[model samples]
Target: MEQWLGSLIKSGKRVVAPVKHDDIVDFAVISSPAQVADDYVQTRLSAKQYVFPKAEVLFSYKKDGKDVTIDDVNTDEFPETVLWKLHPCDVAGLEPLGAIFNWDYKDSLYNARRAKTTLVTFACAASDEYCFCASVGGGPGNTDGSDVQVTMLPDGDALVELISDKGKALLTDDIKGETSSADGIDKEKFIAKVEKKFTVDEIIKKLEGSFSSPIWQEQSDRCLGCGACAYVCPTCACFDIQEDSHLHGGRRVRSWDSCGFSLFTLHTGGYNPRTTQSARWRQRVLHKFSYMPERLHVTGCTGCGRCSRACPVDMNLVEHLTEIASHE
Candidate 1:
């Protein structure tokens, strides 16, 4: 499918995938095969931007008189975009985000983009000290949110496993002939490795018990509250709604916000719910580990370790979970 993907992009079709730039791989629009790099450790940004862009103009507005006309963003002409070689962690993060977006009021912009894009996740073999996807129900070959999953086996043969209709449609009748057993994927070994490092059931219990612990404040003392961690996190989906104006009139804009920001929980009446980095950090953990799971029936963390990787202070999320989970 990689070669086929290259053909589509080269042929001027919209095939957005991961490409290396400035020594870091990021998902971008590609026009050739030479542009892609599958071995990139972790992208500086998450795959969420394809669906929810960093700085998207929700709509444009103009006012001629007391009667103002609002023009809704034209998403009716979106193109078919294919995301290739995404990690399981980045892919799985999209699940919980869907709930919040579709709740109360529907976000047509985000939903429209998602509907047009097909996710093709590439399995990862390399593990880092900060990575704990195994603990979060992810592995080297997890196929959760992936429509098409490409697994590179030790024998130098690639395994193309299709999970959804979009994945099924990508295969030509000729390449469809290569049907090998998935038994060699080693599901048991992948699962066992995660279980040895962490216990999901016990960790959930510990997370439930420590909501008001003083450790939260002590651990977060050095945090700068720059919002970098949450901004880079695929699972962090907090957003801000505002009005972008040009004197005559304005349009309402919704942009990505972070819980790490001091202004995040600030009320319009001038009361700040979470006033410090310690409080903000606590909210981040609770939202991912408790509140989201309670409402969404799934934890918000993918354990991709991007937060740890991108943190200016080098605050490790894996270490945080392990410390609390192992505490007596």
Candidate 2:
């Protein structure tokens, strides 16, 4: 794996992998294989930033004496990239993101970046209690959105399975290994070792009647309104746009925002729609399980469990969903 990564980096394609940054492990561009972390079950942030950045300058404008100029951010600089070592669930999380971006209108910037990247997924060797991939129509080895899926055998040899033409193009004749096929490899058996926490049908059914339930307030009263959950989520694509202007010129900037924050729904007037934490929390849950599935034909979450793990106040999504399921 290290040899393959080194070869990719040497070929001028940017390699982004889970690398250790102080106490947290997040996806970062790597110049060498040594920077990749081996100890983390999941990264602090998802690989979505490679396509959708945290903050991006959409366009810049300048004015001078009845003259104005508008410039778009250069799309030519988006590097040919490879996302390595992300889990299959993380790769699947991109599905909802892609749907929303391409829904009403096409975002050419996102499309350009996405077209140049290839995802290389590593099957889970183990799963923790926080993981609920199976409950959300994904599994440890499910290759829903991966270009290539690599499974490490018990003997430490990796079986690289190409799932797309882009994945096949990545491997050249110079890349050598013990070549084999995925003829008898039952990845589902490997995934079955992990226990499922809930059923998707049951949870969605329970949510059908939970629109006005007081359980939202009960669960969200303890929330600190930190917005950490959405920040770590791969499918949360809400963003806020702002214009920074000088005396004569300015630029429009787009930055990520979250429903968990109090200021998210604040209006210019002294009115707020989703005013309380309970309302915000309800939106978060419904957006993932209800609204997204109904409108976009895809669950807004991939069940990677990053939101639960990153929540400082110990908000457990699976526990709340299970509680909602048992209500009726």
Candidate 3:
């Protein structure tokens, strides 16, 4: 692992990997392989930040007298990068994000970074109670958006599957792995061992008419409106564009926003469509389970379970979904 990471860095490409900061593990740019952590189940934040930044200056402007000069932030400056040690679920999470950004109108900033980034994902060997990857049509060995999928063998070696042209470009003669069909036999078995509590399809079917359900209000009553779910989510694409101005200069910035907050649906005329916590919660649930899947033909929830872990009130998504499913 060290040698492979070092090879990537020595090749003059920026390498981002899971780094340990105290008790938390998150992906960050690493100069050396030693900075990578080994004992992390899932990253605190997904790898989506590389493609879609949390906040960025879109353009800057200056005003003097009556003339205004505008300067756009360069979207083409992204360096060739390798995202290593990402879990399969996180890799699959990027699929929905890419779909939304490229659905009707293409986002040049997102496309530019995605074009330059190569994803190297590690298959999950185990899972926790909060994880429902299989339930959402994903597994430890599922390779949806990964450029290269890597499965750990019993002998401490890796079985590498090159998934795309970007994945193939990073391969070197020193990297030894089988890219043939024989490698999948064991991987399928490994994936078969993974168990999910319930199917996302079942939840989606239940969510079809749940907009007026009383369960949303009951479940969301304790929600602090912290927006942690959207912040950590890999597929949540809501953002707000704002312009910051001084006396003579300013910049237009794009930052992440969340439907969990009341201000998200606020109108300039002092009316908010989603006025109550129940309405906001319903939007969050429906957006992922109903709306996005209906539009993109892909499930918005990746079942990574970060939102459940990060929730201050212990608002478990699986539990709520299961309860909703049981309702008539």
Candidate 4:
């Protein structure tokens, strides 16, 4: 089946899958299924904006001083994109993005492109010290938001499970593989052995109780407020609105932003709502572990653990959550 799938994808049909680059794996246009990099434990880039880019132009505008004209950008230009070999958290992160992009204002630039893309995810058979998807309800080898889920058999063969029609289309007779029900697999056993060690409910509940906890200040003391954690996080969805202009015309653009920045909540009066790193860190934790749940039915974390890995001061989510969860 693997060989057949590779042949189908290689037929110049515009398929993209994860491929290894340097120390991390990233999704790219694959000429064949053999180019897919399921062996990589994690990806450097969160699978967030392959569908909704980090920055996009909503529309362009022109003004005759008294008259301002707004021209909505054409949505028909978005191309179909495919993503494969995603971890559990990266897959689930898309849902939270849907909440905000679809809130009061519908972002056509994002939703239009997202609609044209299909996501194919693979369960993580093994994870490093930084992974903790299991604690967030997505364990190693877990499939939450994927259209198709893949598993590597003990004999190094691959199993394909189509969770959605979009996923089934990725298959071809040339790939010659068997189908199985992934539903009954022993997910807990897989997580217990290799996935990160953490508890999702406990962290969420602890966050709910730690709104004013002094630990936020202490835990965030070493934070440089660089926003790297937010940038690398799979579920961080804050964005800033801006207008780009030339001499005669301009357009409104939205780019990914982070709450970790000192000026994220700044006002014109020079008052910053979250000036300190602790306050910013507190906001980050509360937003993902608490506030997001209130707004969306799902937790905002997919638990890829990149933030924990990327922190300059070594701010570990597992350590922070463990301490916070133990406060009770």
Candidate 5:
């Protein structure tokens, strides 16, 4: 693994992997295997930022008298990036996240970045209470959006599955061992057991008639409207475009936004559509379970449980969704 990573770095491909920083695990650029976190169950943040930046300049404009000059961002300069050691759930999230950007009008900027990024996912050998990937059409071994899937065996060797041409392209002669038949290897035995709490279909169906349910209020009463959930969520693609102006020039920037924010739905006329936390909370759940599934034919969540982990108020998504699914 170290040699392969070193080779990629030497080849000028930017490799971002999970790294442990002061006991917190998050994705960071690494040049060596020693910088990669080996004991982490999940990264504190997703690798989505490699493709979709938190804030990016779309274009710049300069004012000269009555004429304005516009310069658009060049997508050609985007680096070829490799996201390594990502979990299956995190990799699965790329599907819905990609769908959001490419569903209607194609986002050239997003597509360009996404095209240059390759995913290397590691199957989960252990899980915690917050993980619910199985309930959302994902599993510890799910490789929905993985270019390369690596499953570690009990004997310290790994079973590497090249799922795409890009994945196969990453292999070097040293890393490409002789292909062996896995006639009796049961991958399930090596992965974590994540119980299915509620299915996506059931959640979608229940959410269809749950718009005015009191559960939103019940669940959001303690919500601080911090937007931590959306920020940490791998599939949340909501963004706000703003223009930063100076004396002679300005740039259009797109920054991440969240439905959980209190002012997210505020109108220019001082009228807010979602005035309460319950409404904001309801939008967050329904948008993922009901709206995206109905519109894009994809579940917006991979059940990574990052939102729950990042929430200061301790809002457990699986618990809330399971409760909603049980609703009449």
Candidate 6:
């Protein structure tokens, strides 16, 4: 694994992997295998930032008297990147995230980054209380969006599955080991058994008529509206565009936003559509469970449990969704 990572770095690809920082595990660019975190169940944040950054400048502009000049961003300059050690749930999010960016109009910025990025995922050998990937069409060994899938065996050897042409390209002859058949390997025994809480179809069917349900109010009463859930979520693509202007020049920037914020639905006429936290919370759930699946043909969540884990309040998504599914 170290040799392969080193080879990618030597080939000019930016290798980003999970790194431990005190109690927080997050993705960071690494030059050596020693820097990668080994004991983490999940990173504090997903690898989505590499493809879709938290904040990015779309274009720059300059004003000369009455004349305004616009300089479009160069997508050709985006760096080649490899997201290593990502789990199946995190990789699965790329499908929905990409759908949102490409459905209405082709997002050149997102496409550029995504085209240059390679996903190297490690199958989950363990899971925690917050995990529920199996409920949302994903599993510990699922490789929905991974370029390469690496499953570690009990004997310290890894079972490398080349999932795409890009994945095969990353394995050089020097690092390629003797290929062996996985015919008798019980992969299920090596991976975590995340219980399926509620299927996507169940959640979608329940949410179809749950708009006026009082459950939203009951579930969101303790929400702090801090947007921490969206910030850590792998599939949350909501963002706001703003102009950073100076005396003669400025840059148009896109920054992350959240539906959980009270002001997210505020109108320009001082009228707020979602005035309460309950409505905002409801939008978050319905959008992911009902709207995205209906419109994009893909669910907006991968059952990563990052939102529940990042919430300051103990608001578990799996429990909430299960309750919604059972609601009459």
lDDT of each candidate versus the true structure: 0.78, 0.87, 0.85, 0.74, 0.89, 0.91
In candidate 2, stretches whose alpha carbon ends up further than 4 angstroms from where it belongs are 176-178, 188-192
Error of 3 at 237 (Å): 1.0
Per-prediction TM-score, please? 0.91, 0.96, 0.94, 0.87, 0.97, 0.98
Model 6: per-residue Cα lDDT over 1-328, one tens digit each: 7777778888888999999998999999998878999977999898889988999999999999999999999998998999989999989999999999999999999999999999999999889999999999999999877999999999987888899999998887878665667777777788889998889999998888788999999999999998899989999999999989999999999999999998888999999989999999999999998999999999888888999999989889999999998899
lDDT of 5 at 296: 94
Q: Rank the candidates by lDDT, best first.
A: 6, 5, 2, 3, 1, 4
- State model 4's lDDT: 0.74
lDDT of candidate 6 at residue 285, scale 0 to 100: 94
CA displacement after TM-score superposition, residue 16 of candidate 3 (Å): 0.8
**Number of residue pairs clashing in candidate 6, backbone atoms closer than 3 angstroms, sequence gap of 3 or more or interchain:** 0
Q: Per-residue lDDT for 1-328 in model 3, tens only?
A: 6777788999999999999998899999999999988766778888889988999888899999899999877866779989998888888878898899999999888888888889999888767777878878888888888999877777676778889998888886565552345433567645325577678778888988777788899999999887898999888889999989999999998999999998999999998898898899889989998998899988898888889988889989878877877778
Model 6 worst lDDT window (10 residues): 176-185
What candidate 5 gets wrong by more than 4 Å, as runs, is: 177-183
Q: Write the per-residue lDDT of candidate 4 for residues 1-328, one digit (tens) a residue.
A: 4565565465544566678877777767777666667556677778776765688888898888788888998887766666666666677788888886786788777688778777777667777888777677776666667887766667665666688887777676544345445665654443324544567677777777677789999898888888788877777878889989986789998888988888889998998877788888888888888887777666777778889888889999978877887887
Query: Model 1 RMSD to the real structure?
Result: 2.6
Task: Kindly list the per-residue Cα lDDT of model 5 for residues 150-190, writing each as its tens digit.
Answer: 88898876788899999999887776674577767888888
Clashes of each: 0, 0, 0, 9, 0, 0
| Candidate topping lDDT | 6
Looking at model 6, the pairs that clash are: none
Better model by TM-score, 3 or 6?
6
| Number of the candidate with higher lDDT, 2 or 6 | 6
